[model samples]
Target: MRAELFDPRTEAVPAEWDKFLRDEGAPAAWDAGALAAVAWTSLRTVLLGVVADGGQAVALFCGDFGSPRRRNPVYSPVGGPGRPGVYFSRILMGFDEGFLFATHLDHAGRVAARRAFERALKARLGRRCLGVVYQNVSAAALPVMRTAARLCRPVSPNTVLVNRWQSMEEYFAGLPRDRRRRLRRTYADVDADSGLRVGAGVPAVDPVEAARLEQLTRLKHLSPGEVLVPLPSLYFERLNHRDGVRYFVHTDPATGALLSFDLSFEHAAGLVTTVTGSAAGAATGRGLYWDLYLREIEYAIERGVPRLEFGKGLVELKARFGCVTVPQYAVAAPL
Candidate 1:
């Protein structure tokens, strides 16, 4: 019943922050509109509230992180311990030095929510610079965050586990039709090539310019970086300033030129392509990225959107339309 600091004029704290990250069960990007659009994780919009206590309601919530080159070993500011969901991605600044990435929190004992999140990170950054804050694993979360990161002791902490697909055509009819016929002959040879007019839109989304931030850093070398641009291009122009999101582009009507793109979000089934890009040298057609991913999966089934996640890696051209292969995990514990 302590810790506090959240305040964006605080009114609709997303129904108490999406019921405290869904009762802290841990996913859906830690609910409440992904902690209100991550704003480059300034300790999650400068939050610090942990409030609720005794009766329970207070597992954790912290803030005040840094980046004066985070001890300067290479560099990776790409968002903080990655929050907005399940849990475990520590930096408690005390001897516990936590970590529990990709955690589902394997069921067992809570151990008092692991000593109250390491006693609120050793009472806010103390006790021997407690670093590494990563824990939990998710095949759909709940193992009590791997028994509260082994009761906050010290060993085992490199985590990753948060990718699934229980439905969605059993995860796309489980592919292999010649990798779904080379992903439908690379988008039907980029849609029977004609001036390459493929379709889908959500570009310039929250983006300012520099040609859409160099076309999303050149679509991060498409698949070479394995879908990851999570927010930059000015956080997708700050989710295009409140509109939040939606991404699927492939234009070129005789010269408008834009070829291909994808970066969805309105999830639950229908808007979740995550990241995509293609051009086929701008016109000729080398499979215009499978005709902009089967016209963004037939525009996610004409918007009914019962399914269209396609988040993790390529998985043989997203299992060539039939699209299957659900096993999302990406651990990283060590602070």
Candidate 2:
């Protein structure tokens, strides 16, 4: 086995990386299609593990060896303990799953490929920068990541998902009577509120307005000294592409105030809400967050998405909406 490094800034993604990802049934974001969109952006480089047989890549990890930036504890910006090393996810993207492998690889083969990749990364980037971090791993990927890493567990930041529901009605009916009543009232209130409208599209929002909305949203989750990363305006603008990414914007019709927004990605037969924001007062006694969840559920049910992944936060609330809780672990492994 051999490891290969590709600097997206200066090199093209090897065909083997593409072939392996496809063979593994990796998500589109892990493929060249999405990687191409990010390779030129803020990303630093990518690492790949190749089989000895024909130099075909079987394992892949993408990240950057950049300065440590302030990231929320809820989401570590990169892979290490704030040192310069490769972070698996891009700055703009939140944790999906980490470390993609060819589907054909069994447990032993998967572990071997990871070890090989780690050694190559250490040789190329030096021992001080030899740590890999994977975030929001699923049950299927947990064992593989644990094969060569240290796992960190957090309490409330677990990903919540709803599966096996046939329709919105079926989903709503399964909720507790009180929760169901509250959701119905909230939906009605949002509908009747002439000042507010839920607009669906992939439009790029004004940066200033986006910042305002983000700030308001973060207030709900702020710890005393936590600093959240600032998302660039270009990041939102880039979502305008025809890919499965979509945004639902909440706005005030009269004042054009950006009340709230949700960014959802269609991946692996599921709808994942990657990010969301709401103005401080916008959600006051309005149940705006729950409404957003309901909207996502309806969208998923209509589109026949087998599951709706409401990414990490407010577990009890999400559970009340009929979403099962799943523990999300971040694994750190030293090269």
Candidate 3:
């Protein structure tokens, strides 16, 4: 097997890269265009492609090389704080869920591909490279990952709500009595506020306001001393026009003020909620946050989406809202 690296920002990724993802039933996050969107804005992003005999593309891995200017949780805390000239490569850059596979390969073949990719990564990033980190790895892929890296630990669980009910009313009826009562109260409060309305689909959002709200929500959840690179307003503006991405927005009707927004990626497999934020000084305790989850659930149910992935964080809280926690792991190997 041979491994080759391509900078999606400058090089045109081979068509086979995305074909392999589709044939293997990969998620929307693995889409070449989506990855390129992120890569264009990131400091350094690379795609690792593995090919077997006869030049058959066996695997494609995407990630970003850590930069001191932008410290991301995926790579920073895993190998210590970010420092100038100290770098690590983190696979699965754009999304925080799912695992990779060397498609159409057996155990031994898969292991070899993993090893080749690692070798290429080390060669690409020399002595300054601290390690290669794989984040949000699922259980089934752990064994293969362990073959190349000894460091592995459980991170946050990815929350998913498997839709079973036929409709929103059916879903509400099925919830526990206490939860049902609280949900009803929340709905009533939201309904009474004629000024606030929840709508789906991408709207012409003000990039500046949207970025501001997203940063506020992001900072509120980060652990102390942890640093994250903030996505610029331009990124949001570009995503607004991208297909397969939509926003569930809460806005004040009369004033046309954006209150809160939840962004989700629509895929054949399911709906994955991505970034979420609320305007600063927005009224709290009115169930606005909870409404986002409920609206996402309703949207999924309406579309017959099998699952609604809420991503990581707030494990217990998400569980109470009928989401199941899927354990996620991170593996780090020093170069």
lDDT of each: 0.42, 0.63, 0.69
Better of 1 and 2 by TM-score: 2
Better of 1 and 3 by TM-score: 3
> TM-score: which candidate is best?
3
**By lDDT: ranked, best first:** 3, 2, 1
Top candidate (lDDT): 3
Tens-digit lDDT string for candidate 3 (37-115): 5665555444445454457777666666755444443332213344323333333333463235655688777777778
* Clashing residue pairs found in predicted model 2: 24-103
In candidate 1, clashing pairs total: 47
lDDT string, candidate 2, 85-176, tens digits = 54553322555565666767798887777677677667766754657766666667677778533855543354556566787678778878
Residue 128, candidate 2: C-alpha displacement in angstroms: 1.6
Would you estimate the TM-scores of all the predictions?
0.30, 0.76, 0.81
lDDT, model 1, position 203: 46
Sort order, TM-score high to low: 3, 2, 1
TM-score for candidate 2, please give it: 0.76
Residue 220 of model 3, lDDT score: 73
Give the Cα RMSD of candidate 3. Answer: 4.5
